[model samples]
Target: MYSTWPNLDTKTIHQQVLKWINERNNGLQSQN
Candidate 1:
């Protein structure tokens, strides 16, 4: 899936993944 983004460098991709993980964690916390 990451491969689909043509111009994203490693640092950008890492940041995006971190942001996504944080969002998912927040969602899970809210549900609890």
Candidate 2:
């Protein structure tokens, strides 16, 4: 059903946020 769509989008966003955080945590310059 349509319920799965939100879950997919949230997961993608979560991963991006994690990556951005990791870059910051590592003190690496990023354009995110």
Candidate 3:
């Protein structure tokens, strides 16, 4: 779970979430 702090903007938060998810998925894909 991610901690929501520092009152980040919606767009920034959305981008951050997307980037983290993509990185996680990419790692799995590369391992297979």
Candidate that scores best on lDDT: 1
lDDT against the true structure, per candidate, is 0.92, 0.72, 0.84
Q: In candidate 1, which residue pairs clash?
A: none
Question: Which lDDT value does model 2 have at 22?
Answer: 92
lDDT of 3 by residue, 1-32 (tens): 33565577777888988999999999999999
Candidate 2 weakest lDDT stretch, 10 residues:
1-10
Give the Å error, residue 19, model 3.
0.2
Instruction: Report the candidate with higher TM-score, 2 versus 3.
Output: 3
Instruction: List, in order, the clash count of every candidate structure.
Output: 0, 0, 0
Q: Per-residue lDDT of 1-32 in model 1, one digit per residue for the tens?
A: 76888799778999989999999999999999
Screening candidate 2 with a backbone cut-off below 3 angstroms (N, C-alpha, C), the clashing residue pairs are none
Candidate 2: C-alpha RMSD after superposition? 6.5
Query: Can you tell me which runs of candidate 3 are displaced by over 4 Å?
Result: 1-3
Model 2's alpha-carbon lDDT is: 0.72
lDDT of 2 by residue, 1-30 (tens): 436567567677778789999979777555
Q: After TM-score superposition, what is the CA distance of residue 12 in candidate 3 from its true location, in Å?
A: 0.4
Model 1: worst 10 consecutive residues (lDDT sum): 1-10
Cα RMSD, each candidate: 1.4, 6.5, 2.7
